[model samples]
Target: MFQKIQRFFDQMIVMRDARGGTEISLELATAALLCEVVRADHSIAESEIVAMEAMLKRRFSLDEQALDELMELAREESEAAVDHYQFVRLINEHCSFEQKFELVRAMWTLAYADGEIDPLEEARIRTLSTLLFLSHSDFIRAKFAAKPE
Candidate 1:
């Protein structure tokens, strides 16, 4: 019995290591990208955070705590990132064009959360949208689609 328990624990450890330190999901990575865009303007308001959390929860079907964990991990990764290319590549490899557009839409929602658009935020969003292969028109449509009615 003791040997069996030890083997089980050993297997668990191996599985954990194989999965890496943290299995940052594609959705979490996408959320991190959106967080980077919202924070680019250097005015991360509480409203924006709240709105982001809500959107992440709804979009990913995550519970509040899970969403919070995802957001926290995303923020840390965003801060550590040296450039946007890594994120763009990850998104491109993992997401479809429509999903990328939805990401841009989420960024737009966060940008407009405080009822005013910051110029820096807009610029970052534009750059990110372009990197994601979304045209100006598609980005605009995404923004409109995510707008609060």
Candidate 2:
């Protein structure tokens, strides 16, 4: 537990690259956001986890071992997070607009994975989309794109 906390906090490390700029783990940031949405619904749906695993693999090319590790780390990170700002900030710093749109789409897919959308889950995605600076049109587009048929 304590070790997990350590690893989670390590994702916040501020490091200078060769050009003296801050760099953070975009993977950790992304997974942490997924963890946030999973918990927001206040129910542990296996379907959400499954959807998230597929989305992460599709987006980042993660294998099973890597996915497991990331899920564990993200679980801890999201539990420790005071707000979504930490994860959103990382994404905004490292991700392009299209990347952020894909994340929003992925989140919508998770929200719909259990054959329904929880109010809290919807709110979480909206907040994340806003923080990502995604336009209302794009957010709506992604929601429609990911909504369960």
Candidate 3:
């Protein structure tokens, strides 16, 4: 009986650690924020989704299956989240200034994917860019850098 109890305790410890494990990387968190930006306008257009998938694949060097899996996981988490704090906290903890700037660019890229950036999308990007500690200059730079040619 004591051995069974000990085994149960050990299992509990393992489960606790596993539950606390980091499921999303900084890049994935950034991608999730961009996903939120794209969805902010109440329209997830095919162009936006395609641009997001392409960006994720190129930036992360992920194969199609891996990119799809990441997007699915990110979508689930982003949808389940109540606010942007979870993503902001992850970015704060794991990203550098340059990386954050790049994330903003990625968000801009996703926003422009539909050919016109909606007002809500712009607002969301501005709010999230500030939350990510990007300066206005950096934000503008990112926007230009991600602009479609």
Candidate 4:
């Protein structure tokens, strides 16, 4: 599964390079997964877009131009993706437990950005939590941590 993902990301890199776009990185993978959350409900909300931009900028410390490029690349990759395993695999390889926990929090936060969580959005996050090897309790914790007051 991961080998297939590696090949896909490799092709993505080559395609992005040929277009003179920013190279793929862990940041891009993370961003793309967040994009997946945004697209999960089949209705893109401006608030979710804003939340994703803010979260990505703060997390990656990317400047405006770089952030824009990354978002575009992420969106394209998210759309073209065959599955979420690629993004999750890279993150699992690189991130610590705390980092993965925070990522789940971020996904929850994005899911609630529009003031409600669609079932589809929650389902996506649940799938991600399992893929990330998070405990069921930790998944609930992350959801509560990111829930708007």
Candidate 5:
């Protein structure tokens, strides 16, 4: 467990050396936000997990191994975080409006993955959208775009 934790934190170095610094950190930040959405409902559904994994994979172009590590690191980061500002700051600094919108959409998808939207989940996404400097229109648009058919 200790070694795992050490390796998890070491991901920054490994990923930075392997890829580049900003990309991996951005991925971590994005994943942490997704983790927040996953936990917003206070229930971790399997569908939510699957949705998160798929979104992360698609967004980051991560293979299974990297995806798994990112998911684990993000979960730990989210749990340890005192607030969302750190993650949001990193994302806002690095991501464009389109990228932020995509992230909000993914959050909505995760919120709806359990077959329903929880109030807490909605609130979480709303707050995140605002923090990401997105307008109400953007929020609503993403919500609808991610709404299940």
Candidate 6:
């Protein structure tokens, strides 16, 4: 059975519109998930940071200040959290499948941005894909979309 959700991905996606109400935030949850992937290999890379910032700006239309704030909040949340349930719930609620596809692609991008895929990073993506309810084909597609040549 699916768990009932009470929140959204912030005002950006607004999972509350017509469907429900806003209970939390937008960038915070998504960014936390990205932060998790960054920490997967236990070493943050310059390339991964660059890729994440670039994608966040493009996707959320966040300026420098907002981007920095979001990243900081995400880092804090990721550090304090023991699981991915909250972030995954928000994404599944607020984002469309296509959006989730892009998000998964972004995860893959961040994972390989350092020009290598650590097993831990790969494992996180795999587990996250399932939690996000993404199909196997979509998962493979997203991986290929962000894979380094």
Per-residue lDDT for 1-149 in model 3, tens only?
Answer: 45743432343211111234535555556667978998899999999989899888887777676677668767876776677876787787767898889888988988989999899998999999999888888888988998889
lDDT digits (tens) for residues 22-131 of candidate 6: 23365677888888999999999999888899988887888786777667767887887778877788788878888888888999999989989999999999889888
- Model 4 lDDT tens row, 1-149: 45744543454322232234534568888998899999999999999999999999998777787778779879998997878877788788888999999999999999999999999999999999999999999999999999998
lDDT of 1 by residue, 1-149 (tens): 45743432343211111223543456656777888877888878999989988888888787665666668778987887667766677678778887888899889888889888888888988889998999999988987887787
Superposition TM-score, candidate 2 onto the true structure: 0.82
Per-residue lDDT of model 2, residues 6-87, tens digit only: 5544654443323234243678779989888889978979998998898887777876866777787788878876777767
Candidate 5 residue runs with Cα over 4 Å from true position: 1-24
lDDT (CA) per prediction: 0.76, 0.81, 0.77, 0.85, 0.85, 0.80
Which 10 consecutive positions of candidate 4 have the poorest summed lDDT? 11-20
Instruction: Give the Cα error of residue 88 in candidate 1, in Å.
Output: 1.6
TM-score of each: 0.79, 0.82, 0.80, 0.84, 0.84, 0.83
The positional error of residue 6 in candidate 1, measured at the CA in angstroms, is 20
Candidate 5 or 2, higher TM-score:
5
Q: Please provide, for model 5 over 13-114, each residue's C-alpha lDDT reduced to its tens digit, 9 standing for 90 to 100.
A: 223322223233777888999999999878999999999999889876777877888898889878877788778877888789999999999999999999
Alpha-carbon error at 120 in model 6, in Å?
0.3
Poorest 10 consecutive residues by lDDT, candidate 1: 11-20
* Reference-based TM-score, model 6: 0.83
Stretch of 10 with least lDDT, candidate 5: 13-22
Residue 137 of candidate 6: its Cα lDDT?
A: 90
Give the Cα error of residue 107 in candidate 5, in Å: 0.5
Q: Provide C-alpha RMSD values for all models, in order.
A: 6.8, 5.5, 7.9, 7.2, 5.3, 7.4
What is candidate 3's TM-score against the reference? 0.80
